[model samples]
Structure formats: C-alpha cells, structure tokens
Target: MKRLLKLYLNTFDGLSREVWWLALITLINRAGTMVIPFLSLYLTEDLEFSPSTVGSIMAAFGLGSVVGSWLGGKLTDKIGYYKIMVFSLFVSGLLFVLLQYLKTVLSLSIGIFVLMLVADMFRPAMFVALSAYSKPENKTRSVTLIRLAINLGFSAGPAIGGLIIAGLGYNGLFWVDGITCILATLLLIQLLNPKKSKVLDEVKVEEPYSAYKDKAFIIFLFALFLFGVMFLQYFSTMPIYYRDSHFLTEPEIGLLLGANGFFIFLLEMPLIKWLENTRFNKVILIWFGALLTSLSLLILNFTTWSGILIIGMFLMTVGEMIAFPFANAFALQQAKKGNQGEYMALYSIAFSFAHIFGHKAGLESVSVYGFDNTWYIFTAVGVLCMFLLLILKQFLKAKNIIS
Candidate 1:
C-alpha cells in the first residue's frame, strides 16, 4: 500500500503550481459540462427534431469549434494566452446563459455555433498556458494531470447533469453550465493573474515555426483527426445508442458515460507515468492505444447484451488514457517557444474538424446502415488511423524528429 501510494504521488511531483491551478479551473469548468452530452437527446425528445436535423446542428457546433480554435490561436499570439482565456470564459458564459431562449432549429443551430465559437476559444489558449506552466521534463505528466482533472470533473458532470435534467429540464443545464463557466473564470482571475505571479514566464522563440508549413505535423494531424472522430462518438451518438438499444434512462446513460471518465481519472496518471519510464517510442504507444479503441468499437458488434456497453467503454477508456497525453505532448514538442499557440491551435483544429464530420457521419451511418454497421465503419476508421500514425512514425524517424 505504501509503495502504491508513493507511485501515485510521484506522478504529480514536478508540475508547476500554475499547472495545478489550471487543472483546478478546468475541473470546475468541466464539472458544468452538462449540455453537450444530452444535446442530441434534447433535440430529438424535447424538440422532436429528426436525426438529420440533429446531425446538422451538431455539425454547426463543430464548425464553431474550428473557427474558435483558429481565432484563439491568432489572438494568443498577438495579445497573450492570459487575456484570450479571460475573454473566452466570460463571453462564453454569457452566451450560454442566453442560449436557452432559442427553440427553433435554425435558432438553436446558430446559437450553439456561436456559443461553441466563444467557448472553444478557451481550448488552444489553455493548451498554450499549460505548455508555459509545465516544466520541460514534466510535459506529458502535466497533460495527464490536467486530463485527470478533466475526467474527474466529467465523471461528476453527467451524473449531476442527469439529476439536473430530471429535476429542471434541459434549460437548467444551460444556466448551470453558464454559472460554472463564470465561476471558473473568477477562480482563474483570483489564482492566476500572470502579472501578479511571475512563475509562468513565457519563453519567446527567436524564430517561430509556422504550423501550416510543417508537412510532418500535417500528417500527424490527419492521424489525430481519425482518433478524434472515433473518440467523440461517446458524447454524440453513443448516448442515443444507449437510449434506443438498451432502453437506458438518462441517469443510467449519464452514469455509464461518467464511468468512462471515472476509470480514466483513477488509472490514467499511473499508467502514463509507467509508460513514460519505458524506452518505448511514444508513437507505438499511440498506435496500440488506437488499436484498443478500434477493438472497443468492434466489440459492440459482438453481442447485443447490455453488459457489452461496460466492456466497450472500459476498453475505450484505456485507449484514451494511453493515446491522448502523448499526443498532446507530441504536439507541444513540435512547436518552438513563441509559436506554441499556432501549433496547438492547429492541433485543436484537427479535432475540431473531426467534430464537424464525425458526428454527422456517425448519425447518418446509423440511420442508413444500422447500429452494427456503424460500429463496423468506425472500427475500420480506427484501423486506418493506426496505419496513418505508423506512416507518420516512419516519416518522423526519417526526419529524426523523434528517436
């Protein structure tokens, strides 16, 4: 027990205090992440929208994310991550509060698009802030710590969100989400004023590299995009699957989703720390992770027993724990000091682009081909993603980008 405890604590030894604070802020912010998980259900059940309509609205959300990521990157470079984060949190909080009024499809679509545009602006800026705050050697662990916080909060969010939805309806989710965003912003302001604290000094790169011009990075992005599409189905279509196929109540679905987060929360840091100690190539780990994710989806087609949901989710969680932190660290390594925002922005945008198409494709495939076929397609995509990463691994080897 003592050895286990020490191993756990060792994972968090070297990250900066600012990174801890940032993780706290992320926890608080993500704890309020109640709406998006249930958005499709709301569109279909409460609003009575067709699957096609829900797909389009979700696509709008993705489009906003893409634009927001790009804008945040540009603004971070011009002004700084600190200011952009503040603006994004405050403005997005206001937008969420107002978003509940829109009932029509067009209005909801536009509202969500605008809300995500403002909300997602926080992502790239936060990544840049994280890079600045973490020690060079502790970057991946820092990412894992932040993800631990995120998943911990996410674990709670949906369960509480389920209760909220049952008690006050979907409108309640928006208000709660908005209030939490503002609360997180306040915490950020109090704890992490860059001017007041001198810990997170931004290192200026003498010559910043352009992410747009990086050919290898572009290939990496495509691989990352494929991973994102497979992962994101958890939020978008998987719930609907739980509802229609398993006849799960909202709270049950919430708990199932929360289980994924909780599993990650408990085990990811230790797993990441162990992986980092090994001399294994990070890309190989990423490939193995992707392979697990593919199998997770493929397993859904194995049996219709509701127990399979738990199995698949467990596999998916493991895959996520392995792939994501290394991917984040890899993206950070690709950037120079001053150009971190641009590189991370493009990185976020790759997932943003995945969001745009992934949800739509999942829903459409389900509609046309049935759920089993959809899982098959996703499994195939996951396999393709693994191959792309392997190709990238070879290219990186040739360029000596990573040993």
Candidate 2:
C-alpha cells in the first residue's frame, strides 16, 4: 500500500508545474460537484414525489446535459476554455442556488434541468484543456489522475450530501452544493487563464482540425456512444437493479457505490497506464464489456446474499474503468490540433445523450419489461458494441491508425 502511494505521488512529481496546477483545478471543480447524486433523492424524499415522477425529473438534467456538452465545447472553441468554464460554472451555480430556495415541484424540476445543462457543458471544456496542456508521455497517467480527483471530490460530495440531507433536508443539501460551486468558480478563474494557450503550442498539434471526414473518427465515435450508454447503468439502472431487482436496501446500495469508488481509487493509475495503447485498451474494454453485460443479466438470478450483486457492480466498474478511458483517450488522440475542444465537446454531447436515453430506458425497463429483461437488453447492447469495435479495429489495423 505504501509502495502504491509512493508510485502515485511520483507520477505527479514528473509533471510540469503547469500540469500540476491543472490537476488541482480539476480537483477543486470536481469536489464541488456534490449536488448531482443527491438531487434525485432530494426531490423525491424532501419534495414528497414518486419514483416514476422523480425519474422523469431526473431525466430533465440528462436532457440539459446533452445541450451543455455540445454548446459548451462550441463556446470553448470561440471564447476559450477559461472563459467558457467561468460562464458554465456561474450558470450552474445559479441553478444550484435556485435549487436551494425553490420549493414548487415545477420550479425544482426546471432548476435541476438547467443545473444539469450547465454542469455538463463545463466538463468537456476542462477535458479539452487537460488534453491540451498535459505531456504526451504522461497523458494516460494525467487522465487517470484527473479522473481520480473527480471521483475523490464526488465521493465527498455524496457522503456529505447524505449527512446534510439527513439533517437539514434537501434544501440544505442544495445550499451546500451551491456554496461549493461558488468556491470552485473563484478557484477556476485564478487557475485557468485562457490566454495561457502557450502550453498547447509546444506539441505537434494534429493536422487541420477537420470534421474528421476520415471515417475512422466517425466509426470510433459511434462505438463510444454505445459504450457510454452501458456505463450510465451505474447511476440510472444499477440503483434500481439493486433495490427492486436484487432487494438491497438503500444503505446497501450506498455501500455498493462506496465499494466501487474504493476499488477505483486503488487501481485507477496503474490500470490506466497498462491500458494506454488503443488496441490494448479496446481489448480490455471488450472483455470487460462482455463480462459486465453478462453479470448484469446473471445478477437477476443470483440475488442471494453471497454478495452476488456487489460482484456484479464490481464487474460493471471494471468495464467502466476499461471502456471509459479507452474511449476518451482514443477520441482525444484522433482529433486534429485545433479541434480538441470540438471533438471532446461532441463526445461529451454523445455522453449526455446516452444519459438521457439510458435513464429513460432504465426507468421504463424496470417498470415495463422487468429488471431481468433490462440486463438482457444491456447484454445485447454490449454484444453489438463489441461487433462494431471489432470491425473498426480491423479497419484501423489495415490503415495503421492504431499501433
């Protein structure tokens, strides 16, 4: 354990001073993203609404996130990531404030919708900046570190939200998240000056930032879209899966999340490094995707307390750790010099759209088709993704797109 910590610390030691600061910015902004997980529970429990109603309300955020992902990136290209994040954070912060004070169901729903949009927009810009400034050699490690910081910050957010909500109800929770955003905004302005595109100038930026009319980037994006939809199950479907399908209690579900985060915290850096190459990453992704989709289906039948559901979540997270980084790294690698913001933004849009669809499907599947069927559907989706990836891999291999 001590050796692992030493190795993790050493990676940052090798990064340029500027990159270290960038990671800190990620840590700050992500630490405050506490409102997201708590929002659904807040609306349902505090506002006294039903699950289905809350599901629809939650869907509003997903829809807004889709817009944020596309528009945020576009704005980043025009104005710069620094300015764009400032606006995004401010808009999202205001929505968080609205969430704190607002009481009406209609008002609350709208507030969440706006908040989701703003929050989602802000993410891709940060990613674009990270990809821009980070050392090419350390790209995988850097990305994993950024991800870890996010998970760590978000980990605090949810635990704190649980406590705050338990004591002060949903309003107090929103107030906390609001304050966090405001603080993060102040830090963001000081940390990321968009004029600081100097770090980006050193690298051999990819060829002209085109639409990637090169069909490879296009095929890769579609594969990513499928992979993203599968990950959304953790938030949208997995929760319901554990509760309704697996008969786990609320506290138990929370523990499951905690466990997943814990393992990720432990393994993220090394695993990410090992999986850096596109082909290796894709292979691991395929394996994990297959296992995760199969486990989702198996959990429906293996609902006994021998920790089957927990194992299922672990498998799912493993798939997540493999697939998400692969998709992100591959997408970033394929973009042209000036198009980093655009590709990352479009990718974010794809993710947001997935969340929107995935959540609705999760809700409906649990309601109409039953939990077991949802697993089967997820499995089918994974299988389809695997086939798509296989064809893409072959094409890339022939063209020498991936080494």
Candidate 3:
C-alpha cells in the first residue's frame, strides 16, 4: 500500500498548476454528463422509442457535433479558451433544459442534436488548451490526465443517473447535468484569461482555414476521422450490443465502457514516449490496428465475463493514446502560424464525422448481422486505417513533412 501510494504521489509531481486546473475543469464537466451512456436505452425503453427511431435521432446529435467541433478550436484562438468554455458550458446547460419538452423522438433528437452542437463546439478549445498547457514532452500524460478525470466523472455519473431515473425519472438526469454545467462554467469564467499562444501572437490578423492548403494535413485529418469511428463504439454500439446479448447489467456495461478511460489513465505516461514523433506513427498505427482487430475477435468468444470486455476496453485505450493525441498535435503542428483555432477545429472534425458514420454503422450492423460481426468489421477497418497511416507516414517522410 505504501509503495502504491508513493508511486501515485510521484505521478502528480510531474503535473503543473495549469494541468491541475484543467483536470478539475474536465472533472466538473464530466461529473454531470449523466445521459450519454444510457441515452439509447432511455430513448427506447423509457420514451417508447423504436430502435430505428433512436438510432436516427442519435445520429442527428452527431451532425450537430460536426459543426461544433469545427468551430471550437477556432473560437479558442480568436477570443480565448475561457470565453469559449464559458459560452459552451452555459449554452449547453440551457439546451439540457429543453429536454423536458420532448413528446416525440423527433423532438428529442432535435434537442439532443442542438445540445450536442453547443457542447462539442467548445470541447476542442478545452483540449487545445490542455495540450498547449503541457510541455511537448508531456503531451500524452497531459491528455491522459484529462481522459482520467473524464472517466472519474464517468465512473460515478452513470450509477447516479440510473438511481435518479429510477427515483425521479429521466428528467432528473437532464436537470442535474445542467446544474453541473452551470457550476463548471462559473469556474472557467473565474479562472480563464485572454491569452494567445506563441504561434497566435505572431499574427494579429484574420486568417481563414482555406489559406492553408497542405495536402498532407488534409490526408491526416481524414485518417483521424477513420480512426475515430472505433471510439464511438463505446457509446453508440456497445450498449446496444450489451442489450442484444442480454448478458450484462447497466452498471456492468457502464463499467465496461468507462473502464477504457481508467486504463488510459494507468498506462498513458509510460506508453506516450513510444507514441511521440514521426518514425513511430506507422508502427504504432499498425500495432494499434492489430490490437483492435484481435480484441474485437476475442470479444466474440465470450459475452458474459465483463472483466474480459474491460480488458478489450483497455486495449482500445492503448490504441486511442497512439491515435488521438498524436494526430491532434500533428494537426496543431501542421497549422500555419496564427491559425491555431482553425486548425485545431479542423483536427477535431474527424470526431464529428466519425459520429455520423460510426454510430450509423454501429446501429445498422448490430441490427442486421450481430455485434460480433460489427467487431469483425471494426477489425477490417482498423487494418485499412493502419495501411493508410503507414502510407501517410511514408509520404510525409519522403517529403520531409514529418521530421
């Protein structure tokens, strides 16, 4: 116990005050995000929604996110992280209040879609700030801590939400999440100041995304979009998969999905050094692809042991650490001086795009074939992504874009 305590203590010694605040902000935001894990179930079981209806409505939420993410990073650059964070949080909270008025899935979907837009728009700003706060050397650790904080909140939010729905019904979760957002927004309003990055400081003029026409950057963004599809599985398909199998309880499923973030917290720092820089990107993508492929297959072997599923979650997290932050930082680096927000927003777009397609597929595939078959599809996709990334690395290397 003492040795474990000492190691935990030593980990934070590497962090800074900025990192601490960033983690706190993430914690507060996630603490109230009580809806997403159970959203499909809530819409279907609670609201009497059909599977097709829920999937379609949920897919609309992804559509909003697409626009939100594209703007989030740019807003951070222009005004400040604080302002963007403040705007996003409060607006998102307000959107949550509208959930009560839903009578049909159509109404609910529009509400969710708009709320998602507002919420996701500022997410990239927060992330960009988190990334910028860390020294380049510790970027992975920084990203990991934020992911951990989110999971820490995730660990609690679902259980509490479940209880709340049982007691006060689905409306309770919306109200609670809104209140949490309000509190977190106030903290950001208090702590954040108008500041610009060194890159931002160089240009005081308006810069549009079109000004940068780097093909490598475009290709890189598409690569990340493809990679991000696997991530949405945590929410989009996994819960439905559990439901179809009827093998796990809500709490167990939450833990299974939420555990990915926890594993990310555990292994990120030690593993990040291996993920950083150019030479490793190709190898890392391939390694991640194989892991993702194998894990999906293993999942088909058993459906009852959640512990095994959690291990699969861990493998996905390892893949995430390789893919997400590296691609983000790479995108950041690719941006021309003075357009940090625009570039980061673009970088974040892959997630938005991923949702539109990934969720659609996760739903359709699960309905048509089976969740196990979807895993097979994911394995194939992972392999294809690996090849594309390898080719990308080689192209960048030949042209010296990655060095």
Candidate 4:
C-alpha cells in the first residue's frame, strides 16, 4: 500500500505550484457545472421542447463556443490570459442566471449562444496559462492534473445537481451554477495576478493568424474534431438514452454520469505516469484511446442493461484518460513561441465544433433512425478517426514536428 501510494505521489511531484492553483481554479469553476449536464433534460422535460429542438439549442451553444475560442485566442495575445478569464467567469455566470428567465425557443437559444460565447472564452486562455506554467517535460501531466481537478469537481456537480433538481427543481440548478461561477471568479482574482508572474513576461506576442497557416496543424485540428465528435456523444446523446429509454431518474442519471468522473479521478494520473515510463508512443496511445471510445458506444447496441452502461462508461473514461491530455500536450508542443493561445484556441475549437456537429447529428439521428443506429454510425466514425490520427502521425513525422 505504501509503495503504491508513493508511485501515485510521484506522478505529481515535478509540477510547479502555479499548476496546482490553476487546477484549483478549474475545480471551482467545474464544480458548479450543473447546467450543461442537465440542459437536455431541462429543455425536454421541464420546458417541453422536443429532443430535436434541444439539440438545436445546444448547437447554438457550440456556435458561440467557436466564436469565443477564436476571439479569446486573438485577445489573449493582446491583453494576456488573466483579464480574459476574469471577464469570462463573471459575465458568463451572470448570463447563466439570465438563461433561467428565458421562455421562448428563440430567446432560450439566443441566451445559450451568448452564454457559451462569454463562458467558453476561458478554455483556450486557461490552456495557454497551463502551458506557460508547466515545464515542457511535464506538460501532459500538468494538463492531466488539471483534468483530474475538473473530474473531481464534476464528480460532485452532477450528483449535487441531481439533488437540487429533485428537491428545488431546475431553477435551483441554474442559481447554484451561477453562484459557483461568480465564486470561482473571486478565487481567480485572489490567486492569480499576471502582473506578478514572470510567466506572462516570457510570452512574446506573435501574429494571431499564424496557426491557421500550418498545414500539418490544420490536419491535426481535423483529427481532433473527429475524435471530439465521437467523444462528445456521451454528453449529448447518452443522457437522453438513459432517461428516455432506460427510465432512470434524474439522480440515477447523475450518479451514472458522475461515475465517469469518479473513475477518472481515481485512475488517470497513475495511468498516464505508467504509460510515460514505458516510453509509449503518444500517437499510438491516442489511436488506442479512440478505438476504445468507439467500442464503448458500440457495446450499447448489444445491451441496455445498467451493468452494461457502467462498463461502457468505464471504457469511455479510460479512453478519455488516454487521449485528451496527450492531445493537449501535442498542441502545446506544436505551438510556436508567443502563439500558445492561438494554438490552444484552435484546439478548443475542435471540441466546440464537435458540440455543434455532434449534438445536432446525434440527436437528429436518434430522432430519425433511433439510438441503436446512431451508436453504429458513431462506432464507424471512431474507426475513421483512428485512421485520421495515423495520417496526422505520419504528417508530423514527415515535417519532423515530433519524433
């Protein structure tokens, strides 16, 4: 037991204090993330919108995310990451409250779009900050540490959100989520001041458009988009499948979703550390992760048993543990000096675009063809993404971007 504990502790030993602070900030922000997980349920069950309409509204959120990520990257170069994060946190929190009051379909859709635009600006900026705060050797581990914090908080959020919805209803979920965002903003103000940190001083500003011109990077971005579309179905379609088909309660769904976070929290850091020591090829890890993610969804076609759902979630979480942090580290390494924000923004857009395409497509497929067909289609998508990642690997090798 002591030896195992020491090994886990070693995974976190080399990271600087700033990375821990960033993780704390992420933890606080994500702990209040009650809205997104339950948004489909809120729209469908509470607001009486159809599944298709919920998907459309969620797509609007994605559109805003693309805009926010682009603008955040551009702005981070000029103003730095600190101010952008603060603005995003406080304003987005305020908007979450406003979202509760929106009644009409058009109004709610617009509210979601605007809310995500302000809210998602923080993502790329946070990644840039994480890259700046970490050593090159420690980049992937640092990102994973931050993800660990996120999952820790996520493990709590939905479980608590379930209780909130059960006792006080959906309005309570919005209020608590908004309050947490504002509190996270306050914590950020107290903990981080760019003027005091030399990390910001080291960043040399560069042309914002430079990342777009790198052909290899653009291909990488496409691969990320494909991987993202497959992964995001967990958020977009899986909840509906649980609620509508499995007849689980809100709390039960919350616990099931929370299980993903709990498993990641317990296992991801140690798993990555072990992989690193084995001198594993990062690209191969990504390919394997994507394949596992596909298999997770594909399993659902064969069984609707709750045990199967647990097993699927575990596989998906394992895939996430392998793919996402390495992907971020790869992007950080590819970034030219002074263009971390731009590179990270492009990376963030992969997930944002996934939200736009994945939710709309998955929900629409469920509406038209049913959930079984949608799972089969995404299983194929996951296979295709593995090939794309292989192509990306070769492109990076030919360009001598990575060994």
Question: Best-fitting candidate, measured by lDDT?
Answer: 1
Better of 1 and 4 by TM-score: 1
Q: Kindly indicate the candidate among 1 and 4 with the higher lDDT.
A: 1
Q: Judged by TM-score relative to the true structure, which candidate is superior, 2 or 4?
A: 4
Q: What is the lDDT of residue 103 in candidate 3?
A: 68
**Over the stretch 1-403, how does candidate 2's per-residue lDDT look in tens digits?**
9997887665455455555666676666676666777666666767788877887777777778887787887887777777777777777776777777777767767877777778878877887777767766666566677777778888877777778768987777667767777777787767666554447424344455564465767776676667667667778677876776567889888888788789888876767666553456454465465556556545656555637776777777776666666666666676544566777877777777776677677678778887767777877776776777777778878987652
lDDT of 1 by residue, 46-130 (tens): 8899988887888888889898999898888889889989999988888888987889989998999888888888998999899
Q: Rank the candidates by lDDT, best first.
A: 1, 4, 2, 3
lDDT of 2 at 265: 83
lDDT of 3 by residue, 146-209 (tens): 7668778877787788898899888888898888888888877666544422222133336444
Using lDDT as the measure, name the better of candidate 2 and candidate 3: 2
Give the winner by lDDT: 3 or 4.
Answer: 4
| TM per prediction | 0.90, 0.86, 0.82, 0.88
lDDT of each: 0.87, 0.70, 0.69, 0.85
Question: Cα RMSDs of all predictions?
Answer: 2.7, 3.2, 3.9, 3.0
By TM-score: ranked, best first: 1, 4, 2, 3
Candidate 3 vs 4: which has more TM-score:
4
Give the C-alpha miss distance for residue 303 in model 3, angstroms: 12
In model 3, state the lDDT of residue 398. 84
Clashes of each: 0, 0, 2, 0
- Error in Å for residue 4 of model 1: 2.9
Task: Name the top TM-score candidate.
Answer: 1
What are the runs in model 4 whose C-alpha is more than 4 Å off? Answer: 43-55, 165-169, 198-209, 239-256, 299-311, 366-373
Clash pairs for candidate 2: none
